[model samples]
Structures are given as structure tokens and as C-alpha cells.
Target: MAFPFFGDDKSTIARLLSTLPQTGRIEWIGQRPVRREPLVAVLEAELKTDSHMLGDHARPKAGGKRQVTLIQHESLTAVSSFLGLDAPLDPGRLRRNLAVSGLNLLALKNRQIRIGEEVILDITGECHPCSRMEEVLGPGGYNAMRGQGGLTAHIAQGGIIRVGDVVRVLESATA
Candidate 1:
């Protein structure tokens, strides 16, 4: 859920002037072909196994409660961090957990996004790019991903979230 931020990217000024809520639309969602299993295991098999998703080094990391993951960073730090390299988080990321193109993430407020087939998310808040992003993606990495509104939510339901699955926004939440 990466909604380009206000006063952040090329569209910052336009975003501020625009009244339309930046609704994030899932463009091209990608998953690591070779690392999906390990990534899933790292997430699911954690006996509280806290792994910091960092690239090459474990210093700069994606800030998360359990697994440090990045969402908005253009450097795709989450992917680079895991791959042990410094890179940008562009929509063209090959091993991106989820590659998205359209829709503003902010528009999903109080909404549910069905990522792929099984992951149900109640987007409760915005996902701010953390400092670790800068630490890893260079200096201004955090700034780049911030103004674009990222999404934050609790995994209401968890299941296999594979690539090419349709991601639909439920018009209303289930009571």
C-alpha cells in the first residue's frame, strides 16, 4: 500500500492540491520465486524467531514488530535488505513480495484488501517508511517513500498470498 506522499515525490505538490484521496491500486504484485519458502518459513515458523530483514548486513533494517519489512521505500529495501544489496524500491522489482501499480493506499481506510487469495487485511493506519530505510537505502530513502502514503493493518486473516491473485477492495467491512 504505497500512496505517494505529499511534498515528497514528483507528485507531492499535485497530491496536496488534489482533494482525491490517494487510493492505492495493486499493480503488479511479485513474490520471490526462490526465497518465498524461506520467507514464509521465517514468518510462520518463528517460535518468536525475530529476524531483521536486512541486506548483506543486519544494521539497517525494515522496522517491524516481528519481521522488519519495508513497504513504501523506492529502494525496495525489504527486498534488497533481504538480498543483501542496496537498490531502489521501484514497481519493477523482481522479487518484491507484492508489486503494486495503481490505487492510492490511503483510500483504503476503514477498508479490507484481499491480497491474493488468502491474506485479508483491515487497513487501520498508514505505513510510514522508517529510518532504517534511509540507513539501508542511503540518506533520503525514507523521505522518498514517506510522502507516498503507505498502509498499515493487522492480518485479519492469513493464508497463501501468491502472485497473480486478484487483489480486490471489499467495498465495506464485514460485521
Candidate 2:
């Protein structure tokens, strides 16, 4: 279904959505070496086409929509403030594979993006917080992470991605 705003002038909306001039930077990278275990921070990692990140425990089936996960760096501060903490929550605590700053991950939903010099990912959907958030972040943790749960993506093109890499939206989903 097409949104009313995107009915006749869809190109305008598409153009606007695709015109993301600001780029994001990878603030942190974490890998889950085991299920139910805390993610370990890494300086870099390898993305395998149609598969999970190398060294990460998750092994999604080929063409899986959740080959990678990403979170907004700013959301950590928001979640912290929501929980009345004086400092931002650690990226690893949230369990996302990547923490990016300066761009809105939500805006990239259903879009393709290139990271660093090689990796390309397709933002697939929202990565909602699980019950484990309560364990990791105490009471109200789940509620606090409702909208800030970050994004799930699939590797469209594989390569090495590292800390400090630039994230640029390659195109709008419609394109």
C-alpha cells in the first residue's frame, strides 16, 4: 500500500528519502561468540555474503533478513536517561553488532547502505528488545528499549568492516 503522501508524487518523497547527505561512523563493534553470552567488543569483523558475521555465533540461513544488527549511538544516551542513569549505556550491553553515530538508522529501513570500503547491507527491519533487556538493564528496561531497539539487516555484499568506518545510504528501497 502506498502512503497518501507518496501517491502521485512518489518520486518527490523518494528523492527526499534518498537524499541523505550526512554519513554515520561506526562507534563500536561487538560480536556474540556464544548464545546468551555478552557480546565482545571487536575492532573489526568480516561480513560474509548471505551469512552471519564471521566469528559471531549466529548462523542465519542464506538470504536471512537478520544477518547483522545495528544500533544508534545516540539511543544509548536516551535509554540511559529514560532509566535515570547519569551516563549512557554501553553499546555491548544492548547486544547489537554495531553502534553507529550521526545518522538515523530508522531512516535506512528497507534501504541499502555501504559501510567502509567494502561491506554493503540491506536494512531489513527493526530489531526489537528481548526479555533479556530486563536482565541486562533491570526493571523497565524492555519498555525503555521499545523504540530504540535498533535495526536488523542482511549482508548484500560482503567484506571487512571496521571501527570508524563510514556508513552511507546507497539508495532508497524503491530504487
Candidate 3:
């Protein structure tokens, strides 16, 4: 869908923002079996429409906007650098459901994206870091994840999503 543009300059920028041709790959998938527990890395998982991942502990109500969470693979590296770590931060430590690579996930806000062949997610908002980061990633973890926390989404369509699945934007939000 086309976003309304008020002026020529704004229209150009909007068009540019809407044209995201780069596809991403799901590099990792993690599911939290219980609240406050470490996420378990998995090769694949089932998404429940308007609910949550089948194996995840989250039981958000139907149509809940934060049913799922994703983090950019590149952001993992950035967070590691911020923490002065020798290795990239583990996706599980960040508490995100999926770790995607090759696309700027921040650019996907308010858009719908398809993962693999069937699962579709409506990008809802930023997944801000919580105090748990301090416990998981060490002292400065919370601050290091400030802007790199990633995204929250609701399942628009349901299906199995696997690691190595291709991720593509399906539609942009209309203004």
C-alpha cells in the first residue's frame, strides 16, 4: 500500500522507504518454554495465528500485537561490540524469537512480512530491552541493547517457520 505523501520531497522519501527489495534469512529461532527462562534454540517452530509460537511460553490473547519478537543479526554484532565482547552476542541472550540477517529490520516497522512460504507477521513496534538484559548479558547489557533491542510483531498468518527460511516484505502500511 502507498503511504500518503504531503510534498514532492516527502513522496520521494516515502517511495524509497517502501521499496525494500533486499530479502533476509532467518538465521536462528528461539523459544522460551517458561517465563524468565533461557530461550531454547530451535531449527523450526510453528506460528499460531493471532497468538504465539506453538512451543513458546507466551500466551498473549488473540490479536495481541507483541505475540512475537525478532532481532537483526547485525544488531547482535553491534551489541557485542558495545559490550566489548570477543564473540557476537547469542540470540537467546537477547530473548528474541527470531534472528534475521541481511535486511535492516528497523526499516520494516508497520509492514507485513512473510517468512519462508506461509507465516506472515505484522510488524507492530520496537521490542525494547527489559531489565533482564542486565542479568543475561552482564552489567552494561541493558544500555548496550537500548536502541538495538529489535521488533515486536503479531502473527498475521500461521505456518511453520524454519531457520534458513527466506524473509520478504509482503506489504507496506498505508498512511
Give the best candidate by TM-score. Answer: 3
Would you list the C-alpha lDDT of every candidate in the order shown? 0.44, 0.93, 0.93
Candidate 1 achieves a global lDDT of 0.44
Off by over 4 Å in 1: 1-97
In candidate 3, what residue range of length 10 has the lowest lDDT sum? 1-10
Root-mean-square deviation of each candidate, in angstroms?
Answer: 11.0, 3.7, 4.0
Model 1: how far is 169 from its true place, Å? 0.6
lDDT of 2 by residue, 101-168 (tens): 99999999888989999999999999999999999999999999999999999999999999999999
Better of 1 and 2 by lDDT: 2
- What is the C-alpha lDDT profile of model 1 across 70-116, one tens digit per residue? 14333355545544556644543322234443455565555676766
Candidate 2: regions farther than 4 A off: 1-9, 172-175
- Which residue pairs collide, candidate 2? none
Query: TM-score for all predictions?
Result: 0.48, 0.92, 0.93
Per-residue lDDT, model 3, residue 7, is 50
